[model samples]
Target: MRSTTTSASPLPPRQVGEIVYRPRVPHIMFSGYHHQPDATLETSRDLWWHTGDLGYTDEDGYFYFVDRKKDALRRRGENVSSQEVEAVLLTHPAVSAAAAIGVASDLGEQEVMAVVQVADNTELDLKDLFTHCDRSMPHFMVPRYYRLVDAMPATPTGKIRKAALRETGLTDDDWDAEAAGLTPTRHH
Candidate 1:
């Protein structure tokens, strides 16, 4: 069985659970939506404010930010990490930055969509990037949709706002591998 205790952390300890916000000082704990009690169904068990962030602790007691719980992709009967996909995409020579999001798919639960920014004076070839992803990662993790942009929306601290990208959804300029009739198969 997995240990219930977390690794020793300087702040609160590294936890592999929901990041809750609870204060020792007296304060009103916001329980649920303004008028919708049903919205707080998930918090009924613990009553702690869930931040929706998922992370883990290393053996030596270090906390690493994995991705947001909502950002996880269920693809081809497997859970794919968006951060891992973006990391692989960033390895491409033409790519300056990347964000991977899960989009609705006809074949499975969801398909990977990569929104990327190319290096200055560089042209992005969706085919080449797809080929690289196919060679570098698992077939299921390969992005089915590609969108190249001049810049990714980020915060002042330089964190990409993937939620914003997700909100934009697909555009006409975006390239779809399946729609384009390109088959990427895995060789067993």
Candidate 2:
């Protein structure tokens, strides 16, 4: 004989808090401006929502998310901040601007990579820059690969177009040794 069983009825969703109550919650706020009040409140109150970011709260009540929620590089089980690495690269005198992205490594871990735009008529030394990072940032934060470009692709508002760079995959031919003071040899 065959027996049939009915699944239990689903529970009705509960309204824990109103949208206006987001500011009252104690949590870390990200660096970006919170313009969409509705979305922010929903994300904060939803239990299923993972902020997917690293952040902290101040004693007073202000919250701050330090790193990007997305685009975090996983290197040897560590989360490396691409923005942090890019900020370090910008400190170099030769670098006008930079954008850091993650590239897949042979070891199945993500490697930090940077695409930098140099100052007018100036060039960077890849080895020296790497040495600087070694002294300044943690090992996981240092970029494993570097690509020097004339200028970083940016949006009208000056935001770096990281998606475009990622789509272009890191090919050996993309490296500009001359711009990076690496013996002027083409990667290809």
Candidate 3:
């Protein structure tokens, strides 16, 4: 079932929060967590079922998925949105689609790693893509590593399966911009 948020007011439906919440219904709500009384599924106050998913709302009231709560990356003490990074990457003419995932970093928190699919018949240059990102996004949000591919894995419903990419982690073919000593200076 597609998770939805219950409208807070009588006004038209709009995004209430990051987590998807649905009102309690007989058949709709589950009968609590099995054998885990401490693991109640309902939130503190509204009792809305927590979906663990994170997303944003468009101006037209459409919910656009960003990433799962677990997939959120903590880099340099900031929460970097994978979808936000992908959106910037897509702006490049050579990029067709992109997926940003967090990989373990020696500094303790996760570092950004992006897997990008280049446009048909276009060869992606790591330096050029890095330049685009440096000019487009914040320095910390820039990926430390990148992997160019022909296509990205997607679900039957057309959603990018980020978990699969995260499962693979880093690869030998992935280019490491940080290791190469290419530091992105803040453009702004």
TM-score of each: 0.69, 0.64, 0.72
The weakest ten consecutive residues by lDDT in model 2 span 1-10
Residue-wise lDDT of candidate 1 within 40-131, one digit each (tens)?
76543343455566666676766676667788787888767899899999999999999999887788598899999999999878988988
Better of 1 and 3 by TM-score: 3
Ranked by TM-score from best down, the candidates are 3, 1, 2
Lowest-lDDT window of 10 residues in candidate 1?
1-10
Write the number of the candidate with greater lDDT, choosing between 1 and 3. 3
lDDT per residue, candidate 3, 1-188, as tens digits? Answer: 13334423222343323554666566676657778766673432255555666666656767766566766788988778887889889999999989999998999898899899989988889988888898889888999999987778999988788989999999899999988889889744
Model 1 has an lDDT value of: 0.76
State which candidate has the highest TM-score: 3
Q: Scored by CA lDDT, what does every candidate get?
A: 0.76, 0.63, 0.77
Error of 1 at 40 (Å): 11
Model 2, span 65-101: residue lDDT tens: 4465455677777767777888889888889989888
Model 3 accuracy (lDDT, Cα):
0.77
